[model samples]
Target: VGHTIESTVLALESIAATDNIAKNLGIEAGETIYYVKRIRYIDGKILCLEESYYRQSIVPYLNREIVEQSIFEYLETALQLNIGFSDMYMHVGKLSAESARHLGLTEGDPGLTIETVFHLTNGRPFDYSVITYHYEHSQFVVQANGLYL
Candidate 1:
């Protein structure tokens, strides 16, 4: 028996504004934005929750299928956007009522929180995301090789 990671877009919408979304995306107040939320699963078991913010100015076209499938792939292949780098921050946080319900976990459950800001090759920030993963379903591994000269 074996399992594989699966993902599905739970919600995709174009909203005028949201709580702290503009702050995270570094856009002006009231600017148009797209909020994409999805859940990860492994063999029908909940793994983690990921929410991403995309600015309309950066990605002019937004659609459900683009998000439902793979935003990164669409950005690179379809949009031809160059991915420069990403800055990430990780910590522990409690899941909100809504998020916990979606993940089928107890409300206020502790989980690992990862925030990332992706920059384009042109040096402009394009996306900001926050991902939460429970301890039971997640692990962090770092591989190293070679020594300093």
Candidate 2:
């Protein structure tokens, strides 16, 4: 949580077809969607690989420049969309061949998987993502804070 890092875009484009299960939530089948993927690194060491799909119709102004920088920035500012809430689910998994390749690990290596769902201000699901964390290198801790009146 306190490290300088760099990001690299692995792929970013609009796809008319998607296999994402969240499509059924609102987006129509065969509808266009923005598929964004990137790798996060600290001092050149890969930390995680994140891949997300956004409903194009909901965030249609996205461009390559925005993708290379920050999609959330564009989503919140340029698009003027509010992120109502999000849900995260985490689990341990065996790294898939593709995920392993992206993280520079051998197949069958340990991986931490997290799936996230984001809802917009209108209460419509707008984004869904799957992130793979390098189990050997990742250090994640959650803290709890409560405010009382």
Best by lDDT: 1
Alpha-carbon shift of residue 111 in model 2 (angstroms) = 0.3
Candidate 2 lDDT: 0.80
Clashing pairs in 1: none
Per-residue CA lDDT of candidate 2, range 1-149, in tens?
A: 57766678888887764555445337767788888889988766898999888887787766667776667777888888998977789989798899999999999999999998889877888888888998777787775687655
Q: What is the alpha-carbon lDDT for the whole of candidate 1?
A: 0.82
Cα lDDT tens digits, model 1, 21-107, are: 777677876888888889978777787888888888888886887876668889999889998988889988788887788778888
CA RMSD of all predictions: 3.6, 3.4
Look at candidate 2 and give me any clashing residue pairs: none
Assess the local accuracy of residue 69 in candidate 1 as a C-alpha lDDT between 0 and 100: 65
Which ten contiguous residues of candidate 1 have the minimum total lDDT?
140-149
